[model samples]
Target: MEPVARAFAHVANMLFPRGCVGCDRPDAVLCPECHALFNGCLAQTLGTAEMGRWFACGWYRGAVRQAILSWKDHGDEECDRPFSEVLCSLAEQAGLPDHLGNVSREQVLIVPAPSSLASMRQRGRRHMMPLATGLASYLCARTGMHVRACEALENRGTAGRSVETGGTVQRSQRLKGRITTRGKILLKNKAVILVDDIVTSGTTMRRCVDVLSSQGAEVVTVLSLAHTPAGKPTKAGRHFSSEI
Candidate 1:
């Protein structure tokens, strides 16, 4: 059965060559042009009222958006390499905060945002773990930081919500009682970096920081692939437009 399946898969690929994950052009998972277009960072501030400084690679638009959606919705595991490359590039370009800069290899850890069991079941695998692993590997290779993705946070049976409908305050309130930290082993004195795929209103990231900080983890910073920038104010009051 395995051999038969492999043969079928080969035949399918031959019939329709793998295309660029971003633009669907033939020959590569992500072509050079798309990569170049997705390489720059967007203008946004790190919402550090609850946690440390946050950094994201680029805006959630164009090729970047398509690439992320492909991996997340279409199971394009091949997107990991390019995605991880961009992640490392972003990390290097945007240096870690001064507080996190002093932590040694043994003192540092990476904790990715926990995905829900229901979402895991639907996806048939844990997606964030691979991205986390790739990022950890890159970090270790570059900075010699002993990186580990701690399963310190849990979803606590909460349903995922869309970030577009409500405003930031309402979204923060929605996630108020959803997440919780696991284990009594406090990361109090340790340097920690939270990893996630994207950030919109930053409500979710703030919630994670609240949980980790309560557990004594010195949550130094956040690393994400894409971010939606805060919009400009209108004549009436502060306004928002979701361009990314």
Candidate 2:
């Protein structure tokens, strides 16, 4: 059965080659040009927010945005590779916190922002898990440290709301108290990094930090694929208004 499946896939590929996720160029998952574009914007951290220091590969634009959108909305799971490569590079460049680096791989864990159950069901996939798992793999491979992803966070049983609908204030208010951690509190005294696709206003990340801190997890840092550049003087400090 496996051989037959492989054969069919091979034939399908021959008939219709996969295009670059970022640029829609044929015959590659992600073209070199797009990869370089994202690589150029690597940074140690985006900005200091109430949640903690945030890091990102670059602004969510051009190829980066296309890659995320393809993976997140269209189920192009392979898109995670390039995205993770940049993220892992950022992690390496930024370096882990002293305490976290000193700890055994088994001690450090990556907690991804949870997608609402309804969204997960609708997509038939757990989006954050893939990114987190990819990042964990990269961290382990690069640093020889064990990295575990904890599905310890849970949505506060509210419908997943769009970040764009309301103004920053309204969005922040809507997200407040809408997410929580569940089951065993593994974060207690453990080093944890929160992973998300993007960070704009830091409201959601702050809320997550609040929950994790209450659970006693030593929140080391927060990471995102992209942070919206400071827009034209919005009331909310900097708004990650664009999807990176």
Candidate 3:
């Protein structure tokens, strides 16, 4: 019965394509204007990361946030293409191609930031896997390097609660020691590119970096679809406006 329903649902979607994730305009995953929202390369500093920074495609607000929420929580798988394109463009803007060395011999690993098991269960998938896989393929084609997406990180489900709504300290504490590497990954001396959907306060990204660094993995840089806007420009000294 489930398969029958899915088949009919698939046919129905073919006949009546859904609206864009950003604007709800008909028959598109992300209409041109909505896709445009994610066009810029915004870099933010992560004090603990290997490179001392990371990059995001855009700020997490307005249409960009709306589109991401739809795709991530509401299961709009169609947005994968446009979002993947965003990351690829970001890679170019961030000079990742040149940074990837010895194209023929180096096999870089694209690892998605871990999603808690509970979130995976709720979403029925590891949402970031598609973006990571897409980035891997793009890098391979563009640089002629062997890029593979590796799920070497996993969240042991300790953060299935209301972690997202918590304050910085609360969020950081909940995530501490919860992110662990998967079984027997030979990450020593490997080049890893960490990908995440959204980054706020850099807690999770920092932890992932710590784990990867512990294994002697050189994380080239971190990339995200979007990141929460920096706070208090006068104080934090790094507030990025929500604009492009």
Candidate 4:
């Protein structure tokens, strides 16, 4: 932020005193203890995906849940930086640098998972785009790849609530044909790192993978800020999933 903008933000914060998004620690957007919850780089199996694996930064529970909900839906835009940093941390934890070492690509793409038109309007933006850009920037600096963040997918508004809010197989069924490609670029033959704020039933994530694959994009793996815990915790205390 510029000097004047920084001063204004500081003043606004002092007056409002929003505190931490997770635990409400004074002056902290995400307290260190809350941030620690996101460092696991939890892994899950996505059977339909080419990469066959995806990762989440934390489980969608407790303080992690509070932080994500505040940032994603309640307009705690300041959390973007902390959350994005967590994602970069996750990339490093998940051996992304080592994986990219093997792929000789001219460019890599960071693709944000799509939201419905209604959801975007409600949130005033595509919530995950900032994270995608941040991850792409980090990947460029880390891997020396010409990385680009692109809004390559869109979800036509669904009839009922999302799988996350509804958490039903019926809601998952509604996801079919709901998500589709939207950009001028087909994303053909390019590497894609899928980004989302949360992964719930994995229904939406799988549908997105299907859409990207149909367009010939080589999806490296899915990455989300948090996920609804649906499997046994590994011995390391990280979230792990069975075949989805």
Local accuracy by lDDT, each model: 0.67, 0.67, 0.80, 0.80
Top-lDDT structure, candidate number = 4
- Sorted on lDDT, best first, the list reads 4, 3, 1, 2
* Residue 81 accuracy (lDDT) in model 1: 83
Residues 179-233, candidate 4: write the lDDT tens digits: 8899687678788889988887788888888888888887888998988866666
What TM-score would candidate 3 get against the native?
A: 0.87
Query: Order of all candidates by TM-score, from best down to worst?
Result: 4, 3, 1, 2
Q: Score candidate 2 by TM-score against the native.
A: 0.79
TM-score of each: 0.80, 0.79, 0.87, 0.89
Once fitted onto the true fold, the runs of candidate 1 whose alpha carbons sit more than 4 angstroms away are 1-11, 47-52, 97-101, 104-106, 183-186, 232-244
Candidate 3 error regions (>4 Å): 1-8, 47-51, 102-106, 159-163, 232-244
State the displacement of the C-alpha of residue 190, model 1, in Å, after optimal TM-score superposition: 2.2
Q: Report lDDT (Cα) of residue 225, candidate 4.
A: 92
- Give the Cα RMSD of candidate 2: 5.4
Off by over 4 Å in 2: 1-14, 40-52, 97-99, 102-106, 141-144, 157-163, 232-244
Q: 108 in model 1: Cα distance from truth in Å?
A: 1.3
Off by over 4 Å in 4: 1-12, 48-51, 159-164, 236-241
**Clashing pairs for predicted structure model 4, backbone only:** none
In terms of lDDT, model 4 sits at 0.80
- Model 3 per-residue lDDT tens digits across residues 4-67: 5557757878899878888889988889998887877777666655455688888788889899
